[model samples]
Target: EGMDVVSFASSAGPNNQQVITEQQLSTLFSNVEEILEANQKFLLSLRQLGFEWTNNPQHLGEAIKKHIPPLKKSYMTYATNFYHAQVFLLSLLEETKPGPLMSYITRWEKEVIKIDMSPLLSYLILP
Candidate 1:
């Protein structure tokens, strides 16, 4: 459990680039569930972090760094695991074909198809 958890997160993201992690680490430190649940420790951790997203949370990284230091080590492991779990859940739903979450995911897919990506083409498109 004490296995340099952030390193794992650093290794598992897109391009194995730890896209979930950053130099300042504002996002991952903000959620205990994101740190623990992703590491397969869901039952041992709190289900929520008791914080809410506001338009501006004010020095949020400072607050998170102060408060969440105890749980910040393993965010990537948690995120990777959580992503796998969601994929598994979605596939399970797909095989059975139809449920509340499945319906929501389907709706999201429909909405995504309507997005206009042309604006980002210059910066995001690969040569």
Candidate 2:
């Protein structure tokens, strides 16, 4: 899918010049989707735990410990890649006008780039 909005800048053919290639965008979106999927899986497991462990408060720590490793791995992946992605997007925005890539950048910001994972990282760092 693609997004569109009004553009005050002049139109240029796809081949005229490229700020980012199609392949780069695809890879970026794929990474974001993978991270989202991992987080969703982690949340689902926690929900399931809430039901199954409702009567086992003492053993909650043991159950929760198993989920943390994978969640940490997923977040570590994000922390590793996020800066490069941010720099890439910011540079692209600086180079191009607000028309062609605007919708895609907006989607990236809303879906993935806007995430603030610092507080979440504290959990991993502390325990």
Candidate 3:
């Protein structure tokens, strides 16, 4: 809690010196993690079904029944909470060109978060 706002916004110009709070960052990661964890469980359920699910159409419903609702909820939560993170990221991107924060965000984009939710949302939203 002994954070220095000056150091946090050191690279930013006077007009672009809005520092991202720790809570905002935590919200971003927590939302993303919830989606990832929910998807992982859904994938695991599908994998567990394996050949039997492919062979029997009925098994597909049972395999996904428990996983889908929670996955959908997690995605909805992520979608709702992502705006703050997007603003934070954009601010950082604007301030930290050719710097460590830019590289860190780039690495995080490629490796930590490779999520594309359009297709998943279509499936989740369609009854």
Candidate 4:
């Protein structure tokens, strides 16, 4: 519960400054981790299917049996939720950058957080 993932933890700002609430930051990662787990499971199921690009009925049928509807649902779920989270985090980073709170954020944080914005990239690398 004392993890240092909070963006404000490393800041050089005044100890009394209030930039982002702990609940806001925690909730963002909580939602992200939740969607990440759900989407990883779905993506892994596709990877595990191991069907080639053949036109055979059996192979195609196996793919179809894997349920495309739910896959699409999961994809959309991840896409929309992640988009909102990314927008919020990006705005937060920018809003804090010119202020004393910016000192609390490291350059690594700015660079690495950009990677968190893409959900599709996760599908490609998760397996």
Highest lDDT among the candidates is held by which one?
Answer: 3
What tens-digit string does per-residue lDDT give for candidate 3 at 2-83? 1222244334534574434457545434355566677778888888888896689788898678888998897777667666
How many pairs of residues in model 3 come into backbone collision? 0
The C-alpha TM-scores of every prediction are 0.31, 0.52, 0.57, 0.39
lDDT tens digits by residue: candidate 2, 34-91 = 5556667767767767766767765567656866787677667756766555555466
lDDT of 3: 0.56
Query: How big is the positional error of residue 121 in model 2, measured in Å on the Cα after superposition?
Result: 19
TM-score of 1: 0.31
lDDT of 4 by residue, 9-127 (tens): 43334766665565655433434444445556656766765655354457556655666665565555555556555555556656733554344444545555687754322322221
What lDDT would candidate 2 get against the real structure?
0.51
**Model 1 poorest ten-residue lDDT run:** 118-127
Model 1: per-residue Cα lDDT at residue 88: 48
lDDT of 1 at 95: 60
Better of 2 and 4 by TM-score: 2
Could you give candidate 1's per-residue lDDT for residues 1-127 as a string of tens digits?
Answer: 3223334433454444333335223333234435444434432232233353254355454455544554445544445444444444445345665643345445544555567433211211111
The residue pairs in collision within model 3 are none
Worst 10 residues of 3 by lDDT: 118-127
Q: In model 2, how many backbone clashes occur?
A: 0
Q: Candidate 4: TM-score?
A: 0.39
Best by TM-score, which number?
A: 3
